[model samples]
Target chain A: MASDGHPSRGLPRSIRNAGWYLLLSVLSVAVLYPVWMTIVRALSEPFVYINEGQPFLPVAIDWGVFNTAWAEGVMGRSMLLTLGVTAIITIAQLVTSMLAAYAFAYLRFPFKTVLFVLLIATLLLPIEVTLIANIRTIRELDWLNSIQGLSAPFLASAFGIFLLRQGFMGVPSELRDAARLDGFGHIAFLRKVALPVNRPIVGSFVLITALGAWNNYLWPRAAVTEQRWETIQVALRSISVSRPERFNVGVAAAIIASVPILVLLIVFQKQIIRGLTAGAVKG
Target chain B: MSLSASAPIQAPTRRRRSSRVREALLGYSLLAPAFIVLGVFGYYPLYRLVHFALYRPNRFGNGEVYVGPSNISSVLADEEFLDGLWISVKYLLYTVPTGLVIGMLLALLSHRRLRGIKVFQAIFSSTVATSVAVASVVFFGLVNPKIGKFGDVSFISLAKADSALRGVALTSIWQNVGLTFVIVLAGLQAVPDAVIEAARVDGFGPLRRLFRVTLPLISPTLLFLIVILMIFGFQSFAPMEILTHGGPAGATETLVFKIFQRRAPGQISEGSVMALGLFGLTFVVTLLQLTILNKRVHYGE
Candidate 1:
């Protein structure tokens, strides 16, 4: 509204608004156009699609291709396996990060500052840097082709600890003292007071972690040798590579793999955005 | 009564000392799980990575023979390694600036107080839902040169060796645009309204105000986005793997993809060296960014 009254602008307000709307609408369409085409490609018959010069809309719709992709790609099994791995990693991250954050926030300890710095320093050593050695470690542990290997390396996250610690620090010290006076121990105080107050942060962390685990690509490809253990991402790749003729089947598989996360994005849109921009934006 | 009164002072001191020790133990116990996981997975692998780079597996296949820094030296001298590094840098150049400009434009366009603007915001950020793998596949189909929407046109050939990296970069830019938009918009939203109003009152035109006032105000966010986009660009693997498979002449083989391809047992030592090289490059870039840009960034405080 403050910008609406600017004196330098020559265009009228209504006309300016209309221009903005038009530009935004065109951009939105450009962004969504590829995705819409993918859906059309997936549903249309290959022969009909090509004959029709790949029409913008599906002609001679074929819903059975989804079933074929689901079966051929083994998407159902991969989806379940991915969901399980995601659960393991997300829950472990939340638990370990909460404990670490609580200790950092409220508990007294030796080497507190040193440990915190060390933990944060791991941020520099991203998984990409350690990919080779980690694969070796997983092999040594005999965790290859196992869910444990897939999820083990990501069980704890330095970023999660830092974020949760920030959230926990926002809990007033007076409340902690009050909780202590009421015979609440460390765990009880965390459960009753700290966690409830930081629910939004926790929720954001959950969605972010789950999204990362579910969409993990490189590690899963390296860790699992068996088709049964392949995550949805790895499965999609194999389907695409193995069935070049049935490109639409691969597209169908990609769409299937994306639906769950897209639904999550739409439902928890705010939390996901906040989670992503957590440290980037200052209060 | 005299004994009870005398014990009060001594008992208080002893109890306080014990309670402090108890608190310290509790803290250590609470921190143990995260430390254990990080030590085994995060820190240990780093140590082993260095060790792997310095040693070659013995002929017996049972032990490793220390070869000093030969692996690192050879890896540096290798032409393929250099090509991969160059390609990664080229990718960074291609994706980061384009993504930044586009993301900034989208954020600025949508940062108005108009009716039903939330719908547009949602659409702008919707690309976040697509993972790198999904985006790559979608783009692969769209640019496949045969059945693609733009495949029939002859003016621009995406599947060719010269433009293959550009093709992968296009997919990456699209996938990452949502993240960039979100971060930049958050930064834009944080800019105080009074600052913009003051600029307008000072008779600054729209473009001039954006450059001088708004841009400086959000410089920190922009810098953060640059660092992140650079990292993503360097670490990019899926787009290359899916779209071109490092392409007609290894044009899109980033350092990470090269390292990934060397996962076999014999090549582990060499791969370790390359991985460390990637780490060194990332560290230098991040440090360079902070040192050079820190002076220019304007903190609100």
Candidate 2:
């Protein structure tokens, strides 16, 4: 290091290093500012900035918003309902996807490739496009105003199967053969060999599926008809629409809706990052 | 090796019949639950939507009554439908390229090695965790007509110019910029460092290397990003619902909102048609993207 310390070389290196540090600090602030604003608004007195006409900063903090949001805001009830729906959908989709992925990845059959391609191709079909017809189907099943109406539609994700199949394919064939030689059946082999090895991918899918379900607004909005049957997202919309004047309350509701996701991010921040970036970057 | 070696020998002959049976039964059984759900929830509704789109709702409001081809012609002929489609197209034009450019820029800046870089990356993707409702709320407050930063600022509000559609679109771009940024950053990171280094060694500048080296390498990720963005954009509902309520006078009435508005709780037929219309639009976009980029994707480790 000392040998490379020519005066000109060190000068440029120091300058560039400082420049990089400065740029990163600026970006970090830009990223954190919105989150800080949300937190401030949530914790502060209702319409503090609006009433005072002061610059939008948290000068005073109040915890009443949380109490109000919990008691009067649709956050608590809708959140529980949303969680229940998300859990059922996630579990159902996971089981269905895992089994389908196992069959697709390991099973040998006529038209396997065709079936797999068709399955993956369905990913291109956005849920919105299918909503009109699916709604009708739900009505036909008399599923309206019920959990079955909400949870029945998205129980199988083609995208999940595709992701899991890729994970399964990465497992070595020797493992499968070893299971076979031990007189283990296909289900047992999958449980012993595939599931255990691909637990991380499975876990990632669970997180993704749950997040997708939890953040879901349109499908739940479309399916659940009754006001009380609303998901957190639908409830938030209702609150904002009804009380456009209470800017602080709306922000509180927004914060309330965001808390679960924030908690989830803190708990499973690693998995979310990995899941998001996996398709983009190589290890 | 020995297992494969054995695969071609005794196991094949001994287990062939049973394996075939096991495979067949397991294949259908595994698929059964999904297939039933898909059929009931997906395919069945698609059939009904198509069927209902050809019909007129009964005057008595009893149920959908088939009038055949006329309703389709009417929907096609409707000026409102045409305008809606045009508005949607305009939204894509504004959102897609702007999102990509902004996303790429953010990703490039944040993808570098710096102190607390992970935190910056998290912030960049934090929008993914924010629901549309929440994001819209933030923007709504910021763009408050009276007291908001942009609203009181005058210069920022001028671009909005009392048009809720343009206003909501601007807010949407702001809210969603983070999402596309995260996705594209992932794509950018997937580009190998070796390739970038080679380009640099060849005397290519940063911009040149980005265009020549990085862009080509990450085309698949870009395509994937675009498809996902476009789909979500088309399906976007809550922002329009919450921010403008599709209003001053139906300026932000998007495809999804239109479907929801057209159908009542049990009006499956009309709902299905609108839903199918959205599906058809997205399906075409997906196929177009695949066709355009399929040859360019270099699948490798």
Candidate 3:
């Protein structure tokens, strides 16, 4: 058996490979079929689609629905608004987390251990747990339907601090000594050395934070009472639910709402995966 | 020279002491922004939630009435709250294992050393793009009794009280498949090829190698996935909100949905109680996984 090219109790190598490929291909189709159907349904004329018994393929193509959904749903405003909120949250998380992580990883100060513990403790009280009170707080501050209410509660993330501290701790002590000897202060060292060395971790955190902020539903749904303040996710809901007669328009809105994040995922696929598994897979 | 050296050393000691104070100041300043935000928004609300649970707003709408721990007991005894908890548990049962198995299968399939495997991996993980809102809409359309692809499937009939949860669960499973697949695949990739090769040399078949060798090696990752998926299961709201609206009867009304419904002005106390109950449930489950299950997880030396 060792003398032959084939292994023990095995078919030819090509056949085995083919079998695996076939299985993988089938699974991929199963995974992708729903999304493809959605795309078809969104692009097809509803009457023709129903007339054709909702065949998998589009019977009559309509480019106008995308425009209609965009206008009717006020999706453009929501997209821009959501993008602004996402940017604010992402940038704020990065800055705050970096500052906190730097202190935890590199600085020595009073109550440092206590503060780190306090930060981690926030994880236990997710937004769901504190939603009723937070809404009151937002109302008391007169921040309802405002970006402040939308972005403030999430501006700082304990998970971000934890992830970043892990990354920064991996920065070599020798490098820190070298930076100090060169007359670099803490901020200078952080900007020039620590962040650059931990680019991938930072990148992962940024992508995930942006994704989370963009797709946020519950908070935005509760925070904003006005149609103008609605995020894309909430707006899509109104579009779909408010006009059940124009189902294709709703589907088109969903597709539009998803396209930006889909493009981000494709472009930064590696960073997204790394971010998601950062906790499970140690560096 | 001795006097000069002593003077210099004493002066440097004073300078070093002052510098330590400066360093502490800088560190505190760096930590201030995050702490303030977390305190006001994150920690304070937690305190307020507890306060709200124990006190209800009086009829004047200005002052609170001290109700003590009565709210907790009342909420606990409520049939709807209990039903919500049960539904949440059912949801957990429906989503977690199914997600784990599908994720595991997809990972194993794509973990092969074959050409164009990355393409398949991308397709498999593509659902990570679909948010809760998008997924709810997609599945809502998919499961519609008249226009849906699965309209004729008896088991997934949304109009039936008993089977509606299954429909919502199907949406959750599909939406979560990408995340589970990505994490599990990462775990599988982390397994060294040399170990698998050695298992083969020991005459271990693929299935035996997977169960006995590979699975044990990746048990830590599996545990992580399970905990995460469980938390996700409990947090699920959008699917129920959009697809079923807790429908036909109240079969799909998970705890989060119930909490959302209790958000009305008069029901804040009750909602706070329910919210705390949810927190307690999540806390206990997570602690169990980390404490008991963690003992069985394999961490290679």
Model 3, A113-218: lDDT tens digits are 7888788778777777777788889999999999898999999999999889888887776777677668786778888988999999999999999999999988
Clashes of each: 0, 4, 0
DockQ (model 3, Cα): 0.48
CA lDDT, candidate 2, residue B267: 52
* Most accurate candidate by DockQ: 1
True-vs-predicted CA distance for residue B208, candidate 1, Å: 2.0
lDDT of 1 by residue, B174-222 (tens): 9988999999999899988988988887978778888898888888888
Q: Model 1's A-chain: what TM-score?
A: 0.94
Chain A TM-score, each candidate: 0.94, 0.89, 0.94
Clashing pairs in 3: none
Clashing pairs in 2: A129-B279, A132-B271, A132-B272, A133-B272
lDDT of 1 by residue, A91-166 (tens): 9999999999888877766788899988877777788888888898999889999999999999999989988988
Q: What's the lDDT for all of these models?
A: 0.84, 0.70, 0.84
Model 3 docking category: acceptable
**Candidate 1 chain A worst ten-residue window by lDDT:** A1-10
Each candidate's iRMS in angstroms?
6.7, 5.0, 6.9
lDDT of 3 by residue, B1-301 (tens): 0111111011246587786677678779989999999999888987887888999989988889999998889988899889999999999999999999999989887887678989999999999999999998888778866567786587988878888898889988999999999998888888888888888889877788888888887778888888888888998888888887888788899988988888766888998888889889877766765563436433443
TM-score chain B for all models: 0.89, 0.85, 0.91
